[model samples]
Target: MNEHDFLLMFSCLPTSNKNEWLNLKTFVDIYNSKHDTNYILKSFPENDNRTSPEPEILLCDGDAKMVIERKVFAFPPSYIRDHQLWHEFHNTFLRQVADIFSDNLYELQIKDVDIPTNKKEIIALAKEIASTVIEYKQEIKNSEGIYSDDLIPWSFFQLSDLEREDSPIDCGVCVRLKISSHFYNNQQLNDSLPMIEAQLIKLLKASAPKFDNYSDCLRILILEPHTKVLNLSINFLSQVIQSIEIPSSIDQVWLATQFERDDEELIRDYYLVVSNL
Candidate 1:
């Protein structure tokens, strides 16, 4: 489906209050009303004593089978200081959900909500949240294995400072951009975008592909504040592409471009701008 169509099927959950939940529900409902697919909410059973349900949102497919969870927040400082708490709450909730549903239940998905802030602390907070969600989801996979259809896949999304326009560049954003760049590209030089994309695809094949071509999958979206950092990441990606040798079947690289609009532009530029060895 198209981006709008995909978004409609994807759910948003904010673990804050009724207003936020209603806001997200309203958005999904509006979007789905235009599309043919179905969207529904799956509330945590009230009797089930969990972490107060955290007030998150879920988006399901036509069959009410596929699901996506959305988590929204304000800034990085809040997330950074309470990173551990977020993880505990999220993990506890997921495990409890798994327990409630058992192995026979349908798949569930998790996604972090996007916040518009450019503070370094806020950007860092978003990255931390993204990393935590990835880690937590990985742990679940390790414990449950891919065969267990009951497992819920998780992803993250955060709005970048670029979206805010009025925000300043934070040291945290620079650090995270640099680190993520190095982590993905440093190991594989000489790797084509298609190849690197392929490997990432393989990594998430059973669960959620880092980038979902289809809207059914929940994704982590990050918005970048500065083009310079985006350029740096592309350079880093170029290095990664050059360093590694990969097969041909891979078509695209799947990265969380939630906040890096400039990077998205550069990805398009890669077609014309050949790497200068």
Candidate 2:
């Protein structure tokens, strides 16, 4: 909690500008004085690819760290935690996407242990997914309906998973998907391009200040965003990285989500980091 102690711990921020660094340091120093223990508050911008909730503040000391991301959602109507609702939403969107892409396999081999595995194959698959994402994004943008969450879910195949599956027919490797609301039925897509631009603008403004210090990283973990919006969010962050007033302050920008695996217990929830950036 001592100013001298904190100065010794973090030796870089002050190098940028005395006034600015002092402001940030003094803020934490005051926080430390309030509590009995000395503390190093990392707004946790998630150092070293660490995965957890976006912490408001983290108390880090040696190997012992306490995360303060606690919240009490007193019976909120809009806070969606019900897995069934999400599953239903995702399933509906998947079915719609399936109907659209049924005839447009684009040469992707549906046979077991098949499809592209090389870099070219990977690029081909990415392009296919990108195209689909754009279509769904457009559909959502053009809809006249309201949304608490307007993003649509997208499903696709992973070459590695598809190839490793012994029973490709029911392996479920080809259908990585999410769910969304039922507001996108036969919606006319008006001003799709404008919508994309506006969304990108929103993302950049929201993400810019997340990294305050030059060493801080910007890593956002989304709960249930539209599949297309996820792609767009990453792309938008990348596009604005260089344009920001002090871009170097942000070392990296990551968009990650929770995933399941064989060793899920060890990590509680593993995050799969992804970014168009």
Candidate 3:
């Protein structure tokens, strides 16, 4: 991530209960609007020594009560570590490349290179990338689109015309990830489905015990996947839920998803799955 973007994302980090209440309120509002039910936020119960396990959010509909247990489906530790390392590598590469190419926009497609976490190795790789771009800039200056051979490990595709204009900072670089046959295989989605199912089962089993105290009230299990790439819907989850044994205490299961518009605006929605509402 760029410095501007890194600052923008982290600076607005969600505090304890304020942001969380807003999120839960949004979900409750959507539920009320769609299902024609009037449920209002009562209180966010505290989890203390007296209450060993408390629901995150409580809703009251006059005489009736609702309990929501929010859970985030997180990525595996190994994947998260790799993702962070890659971001560091990209940032380091940009710092080196910006000094070298200052006037034009270049899209560098790096391939077949194992990204190293060591600072010295990362610096060496970044320098090598900058030098490679400088060496081939003149040879492919006139060409557009992909200009490298199939056997070549990397390809350089200049996105914008080499328009040299006076600017304050260096040029913009958009680095594309390496593409391989393994990424295009049909088995990738198939492999991921099982992982998703396993995660769902684990989350359900872990959260079920929290609802034991709320037997008098309607119990809800809200699962929000930490990613937006997967196309999760009621139908897909319905099929997966058939195999797992849902706890008797859970009255309903809902999947919360976030959608991003072309203008970068975000909209969060909730879909009911395994419902007994």
- Writing each residue's lDDT as its tens digit, candidate 2 over 188-224 gives 2222334533554454454444434322222222211
Over 1-277, each residue of candidate 3 has an lDDT whose tens digit, in order, gives: 2221111111111224544576688888988898788998887664432456777777888888888888766433143344455566577767766655545566667652456656567567666666676676666455763444433355565555333232222456666656233321336545667877888888888888878888878898887654322333334544676667788878898776555567666666676667664
Q: RMSD for each model, in Å, please?
A: 21.0, 19.9, 8.6
Ranking by lDDT: 3, 2, 1
Q: By lDDT, who's the top model here?
A: 3
Alpha carbon deviation, residue 250, candidate 3 (Å) = 1.9
Lowest summed lDDT across 10 adjacent residues in model 2 is found at: 5-14
Can you write out model 1's per-residue Cα lDDT over 122-227, one digit (the tens) per residue?
A: 4444445444544565454445422222222333223243532532432211111111221224333333345544543333242233223324333321111112
Estimate the overall C-alpha local distance difference test score of candidate 3.
0.62
A best-first ranking of the candidates according to their TM-score comes to 3, 2, 1
Please, what is the TM-score per model?
0.23, 0.24, 0.60
How many steric overlaps are in each model, in order?
A: 28, 4, 0
TM-score of model number 2: 0.24
In model 2, where do residues sit more than 4 Å from their true spots?
1-55, 58-194, 213-224, 227-248, 260-277
The per-residue C-alpha lDDT of model 3 at residue 195 equals 78
